[model samples]
Target: MGREQEELWDAETAREYDTPGTGMFAPEVLGPTVERLAALADGGAALEFAIGTGRVAVPLARRGVPVTGIDLSRPMIDRLRAKADGATIPVVVGDMATATAPGTFRLVYLVFNTIANLLTQDAQVACFRNAARHLTPGGRFVIELWVPELRKLPPGRQAVVCRVETGYIGLDTYDTLHQHVVSHHFTFGAGRDARLFRTPHRYIWPAELDLMARLAGFALESRHADWNGTEFTAESPSHVSVYRLPHDG
Candidate 1:
């Protein structure tokens, strides 16, 4: 990741990143995610790409699935260290696409649309190769990503509201030509200025992601609409995909 993009998720954002027991951190969302990953680890060590704030790693580790992480944000890693031991869930503060962690893993996973953070086809491809580098033969690499919502865009429209609540709202604006989406988050409070934070992502289609995996010497293993093992269909908004390296390789 570039300096500009790294700075986008500075300390302030890291501090507010964890929303325990609600939103993405809710038991309903996180539990199944960690469960499936733990199952994939299959009693072996695992590696996480862009593992932020111990959201999934902590619980997975508590389950006795040895977990390690590679991320780019020091502040985010600091927050994770505050929640868990750095020695137990060790993290390397560098780009996940290129950073090296010691040893091979039974499973290497990336979650929560983090693959899109690389922002370029080459970088995304490099990420798959990096995951392949870390995984044991026949090991799996999983990713959770939102399917592009381009069909929801009306003709000549480029923005949509993705979330609305009492104190927060999320708006995503598309750059269709470049296949980019910038999410603008607005938080409101009584007698205070509305706070805004934005994040940009380069979204990828499932087909393209599969091709990237293939280029990295992996084959698509499975895909589901969510962590519950639900069937993926045309209407599913997001997908959890698994890719595996050849046992011989």
Candidate 2:
């Protein structure tokens, strides 16, 4: 993980992460992701990379799938431990790119664009390699990522407003040449002042991600627009991709 990302997700941020009830922790958001991951586990152990606050891990564990997690943020893991027992869902507090836990897993996953947080192509490739290293033969790796919305930016424009709501606003600025983006988020509530947060990411295309998987000795098994297995079309804004190691590996 980048130094900037490490500092961005501090104790305070971890405390307020799930309160918004938007995005990942929303009422209806986590169900499909957990369901899909559980199915992918196929009665085997699962590992989560960058598993902040156990958003998916806790529920997936509840579904009878053994789950482990690795994260860079101590506070995030603290929050997770507060919700779930350490023995039920063990977590390693370290960078996901190189963190290791005991034993291999049948399924390894990174969700909610966490791969972009690596901030460099080399680091991203290292992450793929790390995932492959931790998997048993024929085990799968999954990623959920947003497709770059470059079309939304008119010619010569460098920024776009992605969301505007009653109490929150979101924007993203792009660096086309470097394939980097910084997302700016602002949230406010009645009688409360607005708080702003910024996170940097290096966006990647699907083909580029496939190459990384190949270099890591994995093959693309499936790609979907969502967790329900919807076919990935050109118009899809995001994707859920599954990759698998060779059976003989």
C-alpha RMSD of each candidate structure in angstroms: 1.1, 1.7
Note the Cα lDDT for every prediction shown.
Answer: 0.93, 0.93
Model number with the top TM-score: 1
lDDT of 1 at 120: 84
TM-score of each: 0.97, 0.95
Give candidate 2 regions above 4 Å deviation: 20-22, 189-193
- The runs of at least 3 residues in candidate 1 whose Cα sits more than 4 Å from the true structure, single-residue gaps closed, are none
Best by lDDT: 1
TM-score of 2: 0.95
Q: Which tens-of-lDDT digit does each residue in 1-249 have in candidate 2?
A: 856777898999999887546777775778888999999998899999998999899889999999999999988999999889889999888888888988899999999999999998999999999999999999999999999999899999999898898888999999999999999999999976888899999999999999999999999999999998899999999999999999982
Report the Cα lDDT for residue 98, model 2.
Answer: 88
